[model samples]
Target chain A: MSCLGERLTALVDGELGHEERDRALAHLAGCARCRAEADELRQIKGRLRGLSRLPASDGADDLPTDDFLTRLRSLAEPAAPAAPDDASGTRPAHPGTLGGQSTRPMRQPVRGAGPGRPRDNRPAGRAVASAGSGALRRHQRRYLVVGAATLFLGLGAASYAAGGRQEAPAVTPAFDRFAVEHALTSGDTPMTDPLTDPVNQIQTSPGP
Target chain B: MTRYTGTGRARRRALVAGGLAGALAFAGTVTGDAGPARGVRSDPGAVGLLRAAADAARRVPYEGRRFLTTWNRGRSATAEVAVTHRPGEGVRYRASSGAEGYRPDSAADESAGIVAATLGLLARNYSVSRVADARACGRAAHVVEARRPGGGTAGRFWIDSETGLMLYRELIDATGRRVVATGFTEIDLDVPAAGPRITLRPAPPARGADRPDPDMVDAQAAALAPWGERLDGARLARLRSEGWPIPKDLPGRLTLYDARSDGATVHLSYSDGLAAVSVFVQRGSLDEARLPGWQKTVRRGRTVYRREALRRWAISSGNGYVSTVLTDVPQSTAEAVALDLPRGGVPFWTRLARGARRLGSAANPFG
Candidate 1:
């Protein structure tokens, strides 16, 4: 009832015998979990094959080289455990197992060396895939920040320009003081006239 | 008693002879010197009488009930107030309803000396003559008439013969219709031993700390800052140089006789001998909402606020200045003066710069 985990990779690579492949496909039809893993393996294999066809030294820096693709393909194949005399003492991590999440550990690019240079035991394809996705996310975040800042400054300038003239303070003229002041200057008694007196002002409509 | 009567008649005859001789001398001087244009027989001594009347307003001490009457559209409106004058102190006016107002002597000295000073303009514009001697308010008075050059009496004044105080005055239009009349209905030259009690309303508080003044609000609205002392000619000239609208003359032959200013407002008084108009110019636009129940009129593409009761008031605002013309003249005259003031808003660059400053202030973190 468990999945044919190793056989699924083998089935995707077409390395199994005809009878074995037919048996694996029959099991995959009954087990959705195994079928999904087989499909992911097939896609990864197809991408690696495509990457292998790219010319070496293509001038585009971001594109991984043919040597990196070869290393990635080697990392993708399932191999037996290394012997004790092997220098690395372990096999390179499998590319098929790479979950493609940004949080997953990836190989640091070798400094002062082209992507074709082999340095870490980690799979080159997984590292390039994770790094490329992270770079894309960073670019998207930068664009968002710049757009927001532009909008803020634009709105501020617009508000300032649209704000018309500054008017003097709102003032209600002192009719009584004006009356008294007028009288003082005009040689008349400082008295508020009946016209300016609010109490005497009838609430009348505008006269014709 | 008969001997006293004979002496009085002799004195009367001598006074008449002296008046005639003085008139002749004044007429000869005016004719020989700068005579008025073409048959404008100006009684040179009449100007002195009017000036004396203006001086008597400040020099004499008296109390009386004065009435002002203005006629408009065939109806007359009259307002009466009790007035008390002191020789050196000031004048106090009290309405029948118990509202009181006071003007200090310093204010009158610095400003009102203008009324008498502008009488030369009156003489130049009118053919002033001492028309007659009449009785007014139970006192003998000298009648002085300022006749228009075309032949109608423009103004008449009844000056008390003994005190030289103006007892009554009236202004008449070209149609010989009475425009405005003010006079003492009852006067007592014998001042009371104790001056009348004063209960003047308190002045408004300083700017930004002001509370509503109930008396002022009842009379008009929120009180404005009191104007400083009257501005002299030099100061007025300086203000004009600094772009203040201090015109020397207005329509209706009203010459600027007095000018005063606070920091924000400039008060200019103009008169044509018969009518006194006060124009108050302040830097700002009018808050029309504050003027409730006032009539809004537009003349010659300008908006004027008109209010007519016992006096006429017209207010207009433009070119960063709000001008209010207050007088007892007809409403049409008030409107004309209000409309005649400068119009148009502030320039575009000025407005833009002002707007920028306001924006900067709003954006300041500590503002």
Candidate 2:
């Protein structure tokens, strides 16, 4: 590639302005190879632009057909009549298989059995749905039990925390005796209590 | 000068004997000397000053209004009292408010010479030193301070240097905060003519008995009704012989001179010459509900309740033997004595009640 090789891409993309564009044009006019490359790039850009202008549905292969839409609409509505069963009355020798080919047994309500008892003729899908619902109910019951237990535990803790604290014993003081005793042990002379002498003398308990 | 000595059985015997001597002294059956039953010697200086004060309170013809300030919780209460002394007769105190609330105190310390054993105890417990000369009640006063060995002044006294009478006194705590201050606000030295002789009538005896109020005995009996037995000198001697856990001296210089018990609760009277502490111990629980304004603090895993009333520090505490220590000393001394009481295997229930009382006190929003 020559020095003009890089300029060929810039010229085709119109990234060169004014003087750069004129220089690239003059180089392309002088270089036959660069002019051929620029012409090819121009044709590719024109084709890409024309393609971008086309409608979105130009390729119909990415869309759903009329038959597919009819099928989806029928499925979206309420349950319709069950698909027709095999017309042959003979049971296959392999039980669920006819000549090594597996056959799907259509679900048909049991006529001789209970009124609402449906025959288990389909695949194991119905059994899976039944087991799933049962397990869900059990989980719900478990959640309820767990919630009730948590509520009880929380209440008990709060009650214990809010209850009263322990207290100690009370001993009252004899102010009269204290002051008197204080005076006594202190060097202060005994100030006679006019009210207590007779009672003191009277209450002198006899020695046992 | 050592007030208490000896160890073990001998010590117990000596304490019992001393208690008997104290009992005799309390019963007015003996003079000042209770013999060497308790290993305490009388201090002449303190004894003489106290005797002089007592004599002056009675014999000196003087009239003055005394003001006493007492601390309650963090507040102070004052008593404005007018005192009239007439020789050869009783001292009369009249309140300024004239509420007819004049009640003469009879529980004076009746030591040999002094009216109170207080000064003697003070001299025994504290080292007394003369500070300086001051004035009190408009008279020349000699200042004396009663200092504890560890540090801090327990009490200060301003005495009339000429008359030897106590004119002012102040009781202070470890933090040097005044608990009680009593002094004459004004004085009239001139003696008035002897007014008509006023006779004071005695109030009726308590409990309708010919005898009067039984202070701790009743309170103890009410608390310890089941395993209670009243202990006198003889039983105390017997208990000493049997080896009980009674202490001869408490945490401070407080010497236990007399001990009485009603089966469950034991009342031990301790004196350090000046300050007197009475400790009541019982086997039952303390109803902390009865105590208000009492603080709860824990020391060495034991709960203590401290409160001030009636010019004394009252502390209630116990693990098994609920001990309420009431004293004229500082709160620290009272709390120490309460925690150091005899701790035996008290029931879990007692501690529960103690804890409950502490909790109740803590929960109470008001003092």
Output the number of the TM-score-best candidate: 1
The DockQ leader among the candidates is 1
Q: Which ten residues in a row have the lowest lDDT in candidate 2 chain B?
A: B219-228
lDDT of 1: 0.66
Kindly list the per-residue Cα lDDT of model 2 for residues A7-111, writing each as its tens digit: 455556554456667887888889888888888878876775565446454434212232243234334323423321220111111121111112222212223
Give per-residue CA lDDT, model 1, range B125-174, as digits (tens): 78889976999999999999998877888889999999999999888888
Complex DockQ per candidate: 0.11, 0.04
Candidate 1: where are CA atoms >4 Å away? A1-166, A188-208, B1-41, B192-226, B237-243, B344-367
- Kindly list the interface RMSD, in angstroms, of each predicted candidate in the order they appear: 6.6, 11.6
Against the true structure, what is each candidate's TM-score?
0.56, 0.44
Model 2, stretches more than 4 Å misplaced? A1-208, B1-47, B70-80, B85-89, B93-121, B147-154, B172-179, B188-194, B202-246, B257-267, B281-284, B310-321, B344-367
